[model samples]
Target: MKELFPLKQVMGFAFSIFFTLLALAVYFFNMSFTIGMTVLLVTAFLQAGLQLVVFMHAGETEDKGAIYTNIYYALVIALVTVFGTLLCMIWGYV
Candidate 1:
């Protein structure tokens, strides 16, 4: 019965809630834009990683390397697209 408790999942959920509350605090505390954004981004990435590892079981598969590689590739593409758009539209780099 002890092994059936799903401790990892419960801990992950609790951490997720904590991160959510931390993000919310940035708004309630009226933090500066930079600080708020920093906190939010940190929590968002941490939550995403936690969900991937804990809930999605990303590291439990034999092909975990491939899965993580794909994720990294996707992140790189997303960053490039976002930064490219910002450079052209907002930074006037066109």
Candidate 2:
């Protein structure tokens, strides 16, 4: 039956493998450092998001809005904190 397929888990596993290969390719294929790093970062984040959504089921519940809001807030706080530190440390703006 369809219920026996475990479709979501399977897809998540497949995507995770694909992303792993993508990151490895970026690292081993002699691409420019900047380009390779950019590709790896994008793919890594996308893969993490996919894992969260599919495996953790972050979007499946009634509190999905709250979950997303929390995630957004965390990201904003992280960005601000990192930029503030960098601004002070690197730019001598302390």
Best by TM-score: 1
lDDT of 1 by residue, 44-85 (tens): 999999999999999999999999999999999999999999
| Clashes by residue pair, model 1 | none
Instruction: State the displacement of the C-alpha of residue 86, model 1, in Å, after optimal TM-score superposition.
Output: 0.6
Q: lDDT score, residue 76, model 2?
A: 94
For each of the candidates, give the backbone clash count: 0, 0
Candidate 2 stretches greater than 4 Å from native: none
Against the hidden reference, what TM-scores do the models get? 0.96, 0.87
Error of 1 at 68 (Å): 0.3
lDDT of 2 at 89: 95
RMSD after CA superposition, every candidate:
0.7, 1.5
Model 2 quality (TM-score)? 0.87
Give candidate 1 regions above 4 Å deviation.
Answer: none
Q: Which is the leading candidate under lDDT?
A: 1
